[model samples]
Target: MRLLLVEDDHMIGEAVQELLRAESHAVDWVPDGNQADAALLAQRYDLVLLDLGLPGRDGLQVLRALRARHDRTPVLITTARDAVAQRVQGLDAGADDYLLKPYDLDELLARIRALARRAGGHSDEAYACGEVWLNPVTRQATLRGQPVQLSGREWAVLLPLLARPGAVLSRAQLEDKLYGWGEEISSNAVEVYIHGLRKKLGADVITTVRGLGYMLACQPAP
Candidate 1:
């Protein structure tokens, strides 16, 4: 998923950003509230990891502003403020989840997965298209009940397609999912990954919409 990380501390932000990238998520990192607001305005993200004590504008203010504009992008607050009132304030200000500072990285990742699943309206951890099944949290894929290997880029490309089967995602949209800000994008990067996915999961597992783009094919392979 493409995510925006709003964090101030260099160490923490760098660590978290690398961790998310290792998990195959495309992340854009900003250090303060103003930058966060700007990023939000300029781009669409699957989720936002917000830090409450922010420079320029407060995190709560940023979140309130996002909600005020009726942007429903999920915000997960990660802050050092441990007070119950503070947590409540963050939630009331429109944070979808809150994580205290110095929390376990595993827990953080789990929360992200949970939020993604909820945002996609999926109650189950696994997503299916025809004979293919993907477990996002586990980063595992199976085809016809057998395990299949997929590269990190392949996993990234397949995720959004599985999240909303049958919905057409344009090449630009898929590229957005595969890359973060400032990352170089090749002309046919999406096609390369799509071709790789089809080779592993079966050609019929994904359908090309010609001029439109691509979508998960739910029909059984012939």
Candidate 2:
């Protein structure tokens, strides 16, 4: 998934960004609320990791602005403010979840998975379409009851297509999910990954929508 991380502390930002990238997520990091707001305005993200104490506008103001604009992208507030009122304020201001500073990395990952599941409108930890199955946490995929090996980039490319089966995601959209800022993108990177996925998962697993792009093939009735 493509994620926007709003954080000012260099150490914390670096650590979290590294962790998320290791998990195959495309992440964009900004150090202040103004940059965060600008990033939000400029691109689409699957989720936003927001820090409450921000430099230009402060996190609450940023959250309020996002809601005022009616942007529904899920936001997870990560702040040092442990007060009850502050937590309530963050939630009421539009945060989907709150994590106090010094949070466990595992817990953070779990929360992210939960939020993603909710956003996708399903509660299953593993996403399945027809005979193919993928578990985000385990980073495991299987087809026809047999395990399939996939590279990191291949996993990243297949994830969104699996998450929303019928949605047609354009090449540009898939590229955004596969890479972050400053990362080099090959001209035919999406096509390469798609070919790899089709070869491994079966050509019929993903259908080309002519000029529209790609979508998971609808399963035939049993």
Candidate 3:
């Protein structure tokens, strides 16, 4: 999943970014609230990890602005403020979940997974298409019940395709899913990943739309 982390503390932000990247998530880390607001407005993210004590606007102000614009992107507040009133204010301002600073990293990741699942309307962690199955949390894939090895970039390309089988996604759309802010893209990165996926999952698993892009050959099982 792609995530935007709005945190001013370099230590906390870098730690969180590293953890999420280890879990195969593309993350864009920004310090200060104004940059956060601008990033929020500029790009799409699966989740936002916001810190309240921010430079040039504060997290609550950013949250309110997002809500005012009716942006329902799930937000998980990661702030040092622990007071009940502050928590209430944050939630009322439109935070989906709140985590106090000095919290458990495991819990933080769990919360992130929960918010992502909720946003995607997923009842289960596993995504399946025909004989291929992918567990995002585990960053694992299987074909016909056997384990299928996939690289980080390969998983990035495959996840969105698996999520919406049969729906054509343009190269630009897939690139958006594959790369995050400030990340450079190669000319044929999408095609390269698609070719790799086809080699592993089978040549017929992905259907090319020529000028349009690509789509999955399998639909979710009923």
Candidate 4:
């Protein structure tokens, strides 16, 4: 998944971005509210990690503008403010979730997974396709009860396919899930990852749509 991180604190921003990347998410980090606002307007992201305290504009202000513009992208606010009133204000301003500063990293990741699941219209953390099972929260995959390891990029490509079993995802759509700002984009990167996923998950599990892109092949149960 691709995420936008709005944080001014250098230490916090670096740590959070590193963690998200390690989880195989494409993340774009901005240091201030203005840049964050611009990025939000310009790019497509699966989720937004927002900080309440920001320069040039407050996080609530950005949230208000986003809502006013009818941008429904989920926003999770990370702030030091712990007052009930502040939390209410953030939620009322369109923030989807709130995480106080000094929170545990595990909790933060858990919240992210929850939001992603909701956004994807999934009722649970795991996505299943026939005999294959994928746990988005743990970033784990299994085939016919056997565990399968996937590289970060490979997982990125597979998630979208698994989200909607037989639906085809355009190459551009899959590419968006794999690359973010400052990362090199290879023309054949999506194809390479698809190949790797097929090799690991079994060739019959993924299908090429010829001119369209790719889809997960629908298979019958034994």
Model 4 weakest 10-residue run by lDDT: 213-222
Question: Candidates' lDDT values, in order?
Answer: 0.91, 0.91, 0.90, 0.91
CA shift of 172, model 4, Å:
1.8
Candidate 4 C-alpha lDDT tens digits along 1-222? 899999999999999999988888899999888999999889988999999899999999999999999999999999999999999999999999999998899999999999989988887789888988889888788999999999988988998888888898999999888877999999899999988988998898899999999998964332
TM for candidate 4 is 0.94
- Residue-level lDDT tens digits of model 3 in 1-222: 789999999998889988888776788999999999999999888899999999999999999999999999999999889999999999999999999989899899989988887888888998898899998777679999999999988987888888888899999988877667778889999999999999999999999998999999987865
**Which residue pairs of candidate 3 clash?**
none
Candidate 4 residue pairs in backbone clash: none
Residue pairs clashing in model 1 are none
Best by TM-score: 1
| TM-score per candidate, chains pooled | 0.95, 0.94, 0.93, 0.94
Off by over 4 Å in 1: 219-222
List the candidate 4 regions with Cα displacement exceeding 4 Å. Answer: 219-222
Off by more than 4 A, model 2: 220-222
Candidate 2: give its CA RMSD in angstroms.
Answer: 1.6
Error of 4 at 192 (Å): 1.6
Looking at model 3, which ten-residue stretch has the lowest summed lDDT? 176-185
